[model samples]
Target: MAVEKLFESENFLIVNKPFDMYINSDDENEKNTVTYHVASPDSHLSSSLFPLHFVQRLDYATSGVLCIAKNKSSAARAGKLFEKRLTMKYYLAVVRGHVAFEVADIEFNVGVDPTTADSSHRMSALTTSEASERCLQSRHAHTRALRLETGYYDNRPVSVLLLKPVTGRRHQLRVHCSAVGHTILGDYTYSGTRDSMPHRMFLHATRLVLPLPEEPLDIQTAEPFFSDPKFSSKWRSDTAYYKYRNKEDFKGVCDILNKSYVIGVQYKMYKM
Candidate 1:
């Protein structure tokens, strides 16, 4: 188990996740799971029995930082925050199209797709525009995607974006980015015609803010996978992924919270 620990506390520990890893794959696939990769020998989830509880589920095709609860009590509390839509999740991505809109809140129904089992997840469901409005009003997971830069690739523009998801849906960031005409780079499920990456989707779960007991937990961390240039160079140019190289933004946010998360696994990843 080679898990890279980002930050550890009595309540939770954040780790950098490997690409192509499921947060919680079934036992048959545990060897390829993020839990199996976790380096810490903290006896599963809590009482030396269950596996650690994963509060947030980053898409299997997506890779980045993840929060894991070491104990059952903390796990329950953190899970509630996520379920109640109190925790804020952010992702940095390169979408396929340049978004003209600076910001927009998307409302849609997403469920299992009866079609291709080739895809691991279900796509969007059929819902009326009014019903979509109600979905937004009730769930209140507002995803704001900010366009950073755009470039032409084969006569198409790929937009670098910062996504802030106010609520956590199964694949909210991917779907929301897709719905807005800018599906994430390397996204297979939401691709328009025929374009994808050899690796998982190009969305990184760069930061998380969870409400804590004292002053409300505010922990910001990045996937070590993003810190390296070679890993990014596999598909896109440096201009698209350079923001992640300088982790000053994460440190700044950590300072605001007066909390710092330490890196557990600083693996010297080779470029694939």
Candidate 2:
């Protein structure tokens, strides 16, 4: 499936990024550039001379709403919003098993460690140090997981969650989920699934709230929106995943998200 534009303007644009799609063109191979999809008139790729500057990043496995700053001024303003913690972003994730509830407010930083090439959200780090060229490299790190929603899987609840990042780091969600002992269903690197997620990994970046050009602006939000492929389901499952069928412990993951988001609402405005 090609990239889909949800909305665009002189100041901003929102694109529906597909699973397995790379967000940045600098790293995009000829086969999968976001610009190629937007540049061609065939798809939602727009024909603006102004470039699409990505404000935030999502892992290749994740999907859904991504904001782009159309002009340099908006890009600068939006960048500040993210840095100042004034932006509100939300994600919907499908995790393994059922959630036992009441574990939300899971806060921690995600920092890189030279000693360990790997990081897990398990909040389970036992630190180590490395000396490279007479320099010591170390970091204090921890992360948390909580149940957000328990949707009906034949009257049995399945864990669906809204993951909020306190300190964004590479593979934070996957690492965190893996740390919790309940890895995401389609995650192989984090979950230790021998062969996981035939299609793309099952994470989505559902919502983003952008502030207006006007100072102290009200929040503009995009919600429950998906610009999926035209023949989405026809895509075959390409990867095989290991199922850790732990249905008993997961329930009502959404409730946790709502509670946490409500608490954090007064913090900031996030827009591109």
Candidate 3:
């Protein structure tokens, strides 16, 4: 229930939401959620900020920068940015394997999982051709993954990746990562029984960039659990990793979208 207010403006309220908490719940009796915490009468924020309109959502297991519009006007403006795919979102994750590509531009059409049970939620990543043949409801999803570090977690090879989602589809990052054969750790929904049992999912929404008129907002949160001894260790300190980590030059182009996405990963992380 502890949500840290990161930045607040007249039109927006940015907060670092914790993991394992719902953004909101259908059951009014559920007081353990982000909405309740921010809107509660006793909240530290002003009462005028009541009934905060969430501009976006974070999965129950995901934690990081979340934007809340203080009013409907602001919400509408931000909503348009999201719909137009103008917002930039970055996430950090510890996955189950050493990723083959140091830098990759991944494109997959994500659709409802045909294999998942009716009660659970799952998404499947398919090639453009495969999606048309099997998944009528599939939507285009794209993500750029940059491997920051590779190490062992509990004797198993794991990779820490900085992910940028070009298109915001439900579970796009998770589905794309899993499709690459390196499911994010503790992602039981995608990793299933083979994944480890971390205290929470190893995925976090680390940064968000919104191109709002006049003044753009770029907010970021520090690494939540990447350095914990329980999660990773014995990291490889190759000079190449440092080169990319230090400079801002890892780039890639997507043939599917015919667009180039160049991102600089800045992380001072090493585990011994």
Query: Which is the leading candidate under lDDT?
Result: 3
For model 3, what is the alpha-carbon lDDT of residue 62?
86
* lDDT of model 2, residue 222: 35
lDDT (C-alpha) at residue 98 in model 1: 59
TM-scores of all models? 0.72, 0.64, 0.80
Name every residue pair that clashes in candidate 1.
Answer: 3-39, 5-264, 6-262, 212-216, 212-217
RMSD of 2: 9.8
Runs off by more than 4 Å, candidate 3: 41-49, 115-120, 128-136, 227-240, 243-272
Q: What lDDT is obtained when candidate 3 is compared to the true structure?
A: 0.71
Per-residue CA lDDT of candidate 3, range 163-262, in tens? 8887888888888888778888888788875664677788888778899986599887766774556543534433234222211222221121123434
Local error of candidate 1 at 112, Å? 3.6
Candidate 3, position 208, lDDT: 82
Runs in model 2 deviating more than 4 A are 27-29, 40-50, 113-148, 151-158, 193-198, 213-272
Cα lDDT computed for each candidate against the true fold: 0.59, 0.51, 0.71
Tens digits of per-residue lDDT for model 2, 60-88 = 66777777776678878988888776665
Using TM-score, give the best candidate's number.
Answer: 3
